[model samples]
Structures are given as structure tokens and as C-alpha cells.
Target chain A: MTTISIIGSGNMATAIGTRAAKHGHAIELMSRNTAKASALADQIGHGATVAALGATPAGDIVIVAVPYTSAVDVVTHYGDALAGKILVDISNPFNADASGLATTPDSSAAQEIAAAAPEGTPVVKALNSVFGHVLAHDTPLDVFVAGDDAAAKAQVAAFLESIDLRPLDTGGLGMASVLEWTGILLMGLARNGAGFDIALGAEVR
Target chain B: MTTISIIGSGNMATAIGTRAAKHGHAIELMSRNTAKASALADQIGHGATVAALGATPAGDIVIVAVPYTSAVDVVTHYGDALAGKILVDISNPFNADASGLATTPDSSAAQEIAAAAPEGTPVVKALNSVFGHVLAHDTPLDVFVAGDDAAAKAQVAAFLESIDLRPLDTGGLGMASVLEWTGILLMGLARNGAGFDIALGAEVR
Candidate 1:
């Protein structure tokens, strides 16, 4: 079983952590607040563990479940602790009001994290397009992933499959912007009456 | 059946013109080169007609099938001719390399066309996500639409339905940026090995 470490104690982190644990993959919830992390670990109802933020992650795959700015901060702070590990960035990089993207056209939270990480660290953008409520429930949501390393992408895809989620590889790390913009498009659709439970999937014909 | 006028004699124009004509919509192909427009109209067959660039668009739903910059030029050049018409802006607004958006974050090509068009011209953003080749052939494709006016959106959706394409309303015209970004994301996916035949659909559980 693969060990997945989530670097936040929020809804996204909990959602991914719970699903991973349920799938028999080890779960580690790491947050700046040890108490909150432990509480979440207990609430997850699995053999989920906790670690203080900035500590070395035990799992081969580490998911940064914080907001765009905070995700960048956590990844940058972890530094070498994340080296040689697959960093799954689930940040949408939305603007403050969630109306649009905070990142530029060429950049995304995943790209920022990838740029901030050490040379050997592989950054993968995933789960940013799927809504959290859908993840909390049982549903087939397509997750599009973009990263520079082929081996890292394969590992991330394997983990997603383990958790009952299908992943679509959308090419190089530059496509992170596309993945992030899709979140904005999904939000716009929701606001236009599609609701927040919707999932945006990239499919082949 | 709704009469659809497509501006520009490029691939996008031909694709929309052919589909609209085959679906029994009155097709008018408008271009700077009247001969080219006539050739496209003839190829489109199904009684598709041709018009000069600045001539009054015969159809109520006028689709600006040109690129982002040229779309704005066409809308502005038409001036009062487009007033009271349903203008469908299908520009992707991609930068030179197609890696990013050429427009500013706050604005989009559709919004730009909406602003440039005379008052009372209801602008609808449609068909920006679906590729041209996909539109050329008979295939199911999801067309996300955004417009401030409900009546205009309804007409565009009806036109899309007539052509056997699904129409997804994604809120106000401001969401045009999201629609355009989805195109960039799709291109990024194609670059990432997903190829150009893929389709992105927004769904809910």
C-alpha cells in the first residue's frame, strides 16, 4: 500500500486523506497546528497519522491541500523535506473572491509549487478541478494531471486509481495553468446554476 | 430554424457554417474577400449565401468566427449593423504561441467584442472550447455559453441544439475568460499527448 501525506487539515486535505485511507493506502495529515491535525486524524476514522508542518513527509507522495498562496508557502517551507517526493498540488489558484484566477496566464499554483520545489521534486497538479463535496461522496470524477516528470505522473495516477478516481494526463508542467483555469470555468458554471456539486472532466473521443 | 451569419472565411467559419446549413439554418458567410466567402458558401452548399465584410449580417445570430483581434475589428467595423442582433463571439484570445491568453485577466475576447459592438447588441460567447475538426464532422460536443441577456443565450442554445451540440450556460459574459481559458487548457492537453480530438464536458452528479 502507498503512503500519502496531505499537508493541510482543511476540507480538501481531509477529503483526500479519508478516501486514501479507505482505499487501504496509509494517510498522514500534517498541519501547522498539531492539535487540529490530530483531531482531523481521529475524525478520519482510519489509521490516519499526523505530523507537524515543515517536518519530513513519510509518504512517497505528498499532497499540498492548502490554498494557492498557502500551498506555495508550505511547499517552499518544506524545501528539501519534499525533495525526491511526488508533490500533488490541488490548489485552484483562484482570486480572493473566487471570481477568477490569482495566477497569471502562463503560471498556476502547481507551476509555482513546481518552480519553488527542489530540483529532484516532481510536482503534479491534481484534484483541483473536482469539487470537494463530490470527493466527500462516492462519484466518478475525472482528475486531469499535469507534470514534467513521466515517472512521477505514473505514480500519481496509480494513487488516484487506488482511491477510485481516474486521472487524465494533460501533458507538460506548463499545462498547470489550463488545469487551474478549468477550476475557474467550473466555478463559473456553478454560479450560472450548475451548482457546486459539478465535476469538470477532460475526455477523449 | 434560426438564421446564422458567420464572419471570417477560416476553418472555424467553415465549420460553423457547414453545420448550421446542414442543420437547416440559413447560413451567410461574410469575409473581407467576397470571392473567398462565396467559395466557402458554395462548399458549405445547403443554400449558404455570401456577404461582404461590412455588409449587414442577414441572420439574427451573427457568429464572429475570426480570431480574437479580428473579431473585435469585425464587430466594431459592422457598427450599427450588429445592433439589435445576437452576436456570438467564439474567439479563443490565445497569445502568439497559444501558451497563454492575449487579453487581460479582467477582460476576454467576447467581452471585448461585447463592448465594441453598438449598444443593444447582445453578445454570447459560444463554441470556444470545441475544436474546429470536431465541429466539421457530425459528433456530440458540449458548447458552453455565456451572455448577459437570457433571450440571447436562449437563441444561441437553440442554434447549438439545432446543430446537434449540447449548450451549457455558464453565467454572465464575464465568464468568457473562463471559456477562453478552457480552450487554452484543451490545447495544453493536446500538447501533453491527449491530442486534438478530445472534448471537455462540465457535468454534475
Candidate 2:
């Protein structure tokens, strides 16, 4: 029953918005390109609305669904408007060629977003590992969430569970690098002949 | 039919040696401590021999199966003897706490090993993703190989195939960063209730 704002109109943004709407969460699809956002919003129907970029919609959670290189730019654009709100980062810092990873030695994409956003704004990293097609189909995908704020992670986890997905809490934001790299490795496996339908799940026996 | 020398008596070294011996390759186990290497060599049996740490055993390939912090020291111990040889680096520059990745932004553990080795020596990065127990159990694990030299990569891939493991060539040495980070990610998964029984495999549909 939470309101969610997605700050992009790409495949990932659409996927998250669609799933969020299906989970009974109100969604605002925001994009720099209004046409693209409106088109997606029109396609997604109920509980979904289209809006222009920099529009501060009423939402409990704001998802930055842009690319890793553009993540900082998107966060900067939002500014203090995102203060005290929950920010979910699902972008992987994959290189331009998609051949490998593109991250700093000690920092991660989520860390960069947390640093860019206003203080006290909870940043949760999740949904980067699941493919867009899989999310669209509502397949059983394991979503790994990592953040300093436990309650914020639990909120995202509850929303994820509502959409028929499982949430694996992978400790604090420092562990976001591991989660981001997992997506990159899975991408490499998929590109080099591994089926994208294959999802990495953990089983403890 | 390449002679390969492994420079550790750890689980990784033993797993590689066992697989190599199964394929009728000449395998030499060397360690700074001779007794442990001798014990491992005895356990592996079948044409595998224990050699002194400084001894440059005649081998077409030398795999450095040590920790990231110890890789440079081990390579330096072998000195100019590693010239023109194919040195395989299977180490990831992850912190001891396994919470953070510790490699240069542009470089990786494989690159560091290549730089530490003598000039003209080819270094291939592989086996960082597969677990030691999976290696010992001869499970179907995918090993991603990357290096600057195609010939060296081909040689390493051939060796990997002979060991009954699938080798996926993930392009040049720059891609080694992703491969190394895969291990770090897997470690996180393993620590967080994910068992080591899971192996990452890639296949074309």
C-alpha cells in the first residue's frame, strides 16, 4: 500500500513499475522524456501515472532505475526532494561494452547514490540481478537487498514479496559491491551462451 | 600433454592437480613448505611429484594458486624462471573479511600477477568462480578464462577442458576484474546461507 516513484522509463524502470502496480502499490513513472514515460504509463494501466522528470510525486519509495553511469546525474536532479525518503538503486555498474564491470576500487553504485542523495535518505540496493523479462513475467527471482537502514530494506522486501519474489537481505550498503558484481557475472554468463532464464538462487542444506 | 606446476598445497592447488593428473598431464606440486606439498603429492598419486619451492620444474604451464596478498611474493620467489611461460592466476584481490573487493579500478589480480611475472610471460585468469569442493568433486563448473594473448587463453582453455570442466573465454585480460569479483560475490552468497554445492555453468540453448 506504499506509493512508489520510478525515475526512468527504461526496461528496468517499466518492469519495476509494472510489478509495483500489480502489488497494489501506487506508481509514478517519471522520465526526462515525457513521451516515453506516458507511453509506458498508458501501457501499464491501474495505479500507474506518467510524469515529467523533476516532478516530486507523493511516494514512500523512489527507485532510480537508470544506468550506473547516469545514476549520479539522476540523484543530483532529485536533490533535497528525496530527503528522508527511501531510495532503491537497481543499476549495475557494467561497462559501456557490457564486456565487464565499471566501478571504482572501494566504492559501488549504491554507495555513490547514497553519497549523492540527501542525508537520512535510506538507500536500498535491489532488483539489479533479476532480468526485465523475468520481472515482466513475474517469475521466481531472488532479489538481494543491501542497505544501512534495516527498516527500509524490510519495506522493499515486503513490496517484493507482494509481487511473488523472494528478498535476500545481504547485509549493509558496503556489501552492495558484491550484489552489483553478481549481476555483472550473471550478465557475462548470459552473454557467453548461458540462458538468461537461468536465475542464481541460494540454497542452504 | 602440457606439464603444469602448481605453487601451493592448498585446496585449490590440490583440486587443480587432481584434475590434471586424471587427464594424464605431468603435474608438480610445489610449496614453500615441502612437507605439506609432499603430502598433497602423495595423496594425488599417479605421476604427480613434489618439488622444492625455488626449483623451476620443466613445465609448459605454471599455475599460481596462492592468495592475492601472497601472489606477488610467490611469483617473485620464482624470479626470472617464469619467463616465456604461461602463468595462470586464479586469485581474487578480496579483503580478508570478504566484505570488500581490493583491486585497482582499472587492474585486477590477474593483471597484478602478469605485471609481477617476468616480461614475455603470458598470464591467464581462470578458476576464480568455481569452488574448491566443486573442483574436488569433479562437478560441472564453468571456468571463465581471460588474457591478452589468445594463444595463452587457448592453452588454458584446453587444459581446463582436459580437467573435465567447461572453460568460457570472457575476452581480454581487462575482463579479469569481473571474473575476480565473481568469487567475491559468490563468497557473500555462501556466507549468507547459500551453500557451496551450487556451481555456475553456461550452456547455449
Candidate 3:
């Protein structure tokens, strides 16, 4: 198992941290508020750690589970501490009201985070298509991942498989825009009475 | 069986027309070039007819199966001929390079056609996710339908089901933008080496 450090002690952090911890991966829940981070870590309880904001990430894989707007600030604040680590961005750049995509099609939240992170940091985009609550359920959905770094993508895919989830690779980092759109579409469908039961799956032959 | 009239003598027109013809739906293949349209109808001899460009559409469902650029013109050119008939748009508004979506998030090809057609015209969006070649095969993929008019959406969905394809209803006309984005995502995945054997399907729980 891998050591996974999750930034932002929110619902997404708790959900992902719980899954990773249950899969035998050591987890670190980092937050600006030490109490919130410690609380999430305690809830996760498989020897998960609590880290303060701006500290060096405790895991080999640093998951930035924050809002799209604050993604750049978090990456920049970590600075060189994130250098050479596998940074996973699980944020969707969705505008208010879910009316349309917030980011241009040419780029995505992962790409923006990649630009902000220190050099040599491999940023992969995953866990954004399906709802965080869905993965927390007993049955999880297929996960779509995209990143330019081959090794980084393989590592993330392996982690997904370890938790009994399907990882659908959609090629290089450029595919992140489409991946984020899947989230917007899934959310739009969910709100429009398609229900919250949403997951990306393969076509039946 | 519902009658389906498909405009354009292009790949999509032939592909969709052939499928509809096989499913016992009376079909009309229309084009600006009479010979090309006639040839397609002749190629598909299941009681499919050919209509000239300005001629009145033959079926209750007139599929504007042309490129995204020609959609508005096709709806407006028919004018009163399309009145009271269900107009189904299967166009994907993609940029030249197909790197991103060319349409705004608020509107889609179907909405634009709905606006251009004479009063009482119902425009439903369908069959834009997978390639036409996929449907030309024995097994077809899932078809997503979206429209403001419930009756129009039902007709399109029924036609798709008759062809043994799954039709997913993605809610109101506003979902059309997201529907169009699905095409962009599929194309981006196809070009990025995921291959043309693409079909939109839900995960097998």
C-alpha cells in the first residue's frame, strides 16, 4: 500500500482518506485548522496522521482535495515541499449554479494546478467525475484518470484498483478538460432528477 | 413504427437512415443533390424515399442530420413546411480541430434549430455521442435524448428503442449543452487514442 496525504479536511478529504485507509494505505489529513484535520484523521482511524497546512506532505501521493478556485493557492503555498512528489488534483472547475463549465476547454483544473506546482511535480487528475459520496458507499463507480506523466498515472490507477474501483485511463493530461466536463454533466444530470446515482462505465458489447 | 426523415447525404445521414430503415421505420433521405439522396435511398431499399432540399419533409420526425454549421439554415429553409412536425437535431457543435466545444453552455444545436423553425416546431437532440459507424453495426450504442417538449423526446426515444438501442433522457432543452459537450468528450477521447469503438454506457453495478 502507498502513503496518501490529502489536503483540505472537507467531505472529499474524509471520503478519500477513509477509502485509502481501508485499503491498507496510510493516510494523512492536512488542514489549515488543526482540529479539523485531527478530527478527520481520528475518524479515519487506520493509523491516519494529521498534518498542519504548509508542512511537507506525509505521503508519497499528495491529494489536493480543495475547491477549484483555491487549488492554485494551495499548490503555490506548498512550494518546494511538493517537489518530486506525485500530486493528485481531484477538483472540478465548475461555475456557480452549475450552468456551464467554468474553465476553458483548452485547459482544466489539473492543468492549472500543474502550472502552479513546483517543477518536477507530476499532477494527475482523478476522482472528480463520480461524487465523493458515491465512492464512500459500499459500491463505488469507475474512475477516469488523465495525466501526461505515465508513471504517475500508473501509480494512481494502481491505487484505485487496490480499493476495488475501476480506473479508466483517458490518455495524457490534455484529456483533463473532458474529464472535468464529465463531472459537470454528471452533476447536471443528478440535479435534474436523474438522481445522485451517477457513475462512468464502459459500453456493453 | 415512427417515420423518420433524415436530411444530408453524408456519413451520419446514411448511417442513421440505414439503421432506421432496418428497424421498420419508414425513412426519407433528403439532400441538396437529388442524385446523392436518391442513391442513398436506393442503397437503403426498406421503403426509404428521397426528398429535394426545399421539399417538405416526408416523416413526422425530420432529422437535421447535416453538419453543425448547416443546422440553423436547414430549419429556417424549410420554414412553414416544418411547422407542427417534430425536428430532431443530431449535430455536434465542435471546433474545426475538435479540441473543444464550439457552442456556448446555455444553447445547443437543437435549441438553435428550435428557435429558427416556424412556431410549434419541437426540436429534440439525439444520437450525437457515438460514431455513426457504431450504429451501422448489428449492436448499437446508448442514445441520449433531450428536449423541452416531452412528446417530441418520447418519439425520438421510442424510435431509438425500436432500433434496439438504449435511449437515455438527460432532461430539458438546457441539458442539450451538456449533451453537445458529451460529443466533444467522446471525440477528444477518440482522437487521444481511445479508438472509435466508443459507446456511452453506465457502469455495470
Q: Which lDDT tens digits does candidate 2 get at residues A90-140?
A: 988887876655877577899999999988888999988777877787666
lDDT of 1 by residue, B1-205 (tens): 7678889999999889988888898898889978889999889998888888888888998989888877888788999888788999999989898978899878999888988999878999999998998888778787789999999999888889989998988888888888998888888777766788888887776
Arranged by lDDT, best first: 1, 3, 2
Candidate 2 residue-wise lDDT, B1-205, digit = tens: 7788999999899988988887888889889878999888888888788888867757878999888899988898888888778999999788768776687767898888888888878999999887887788865567777788989888888889888887876667877887887776667666655566655544321
lDDT of 3 by residue, A1-205 (tens): 7899899988788889898899899998878878989888889999999877888987888999988988899889999989879999999888897656688756888999999999878989889887877778747566778899999888888988888887777777887877887887777657654667766665534
Q: What would the TM-scores of all predictions be?
A: 0.93, 0.84, 0.91
User: Model 3 — interface RMS deviation?
Assistant: 2.9
Candidate 1: regions farther than 4 A off: A104-106
> DockQ for all models, in order?
0.67, 0.25, 0.45
True contacts kept of each: 0.82, 0.23, 0.37
Worst 10 residues of 3 chain B by lDDT: B196-205
| Poorest 10 consecutive residues by lDDT, candidate 1 chain A | A97-106
> Tens-digit lDDT track for model 3 on B34-75?
898998999988878887786787788888988989888877
Error of 3 at B40 (Å): 2.2
The clash count for each model shown is 1, 0, 0
Using lDDT as the measure, name the better of candidate 1 and candidate 2.
1
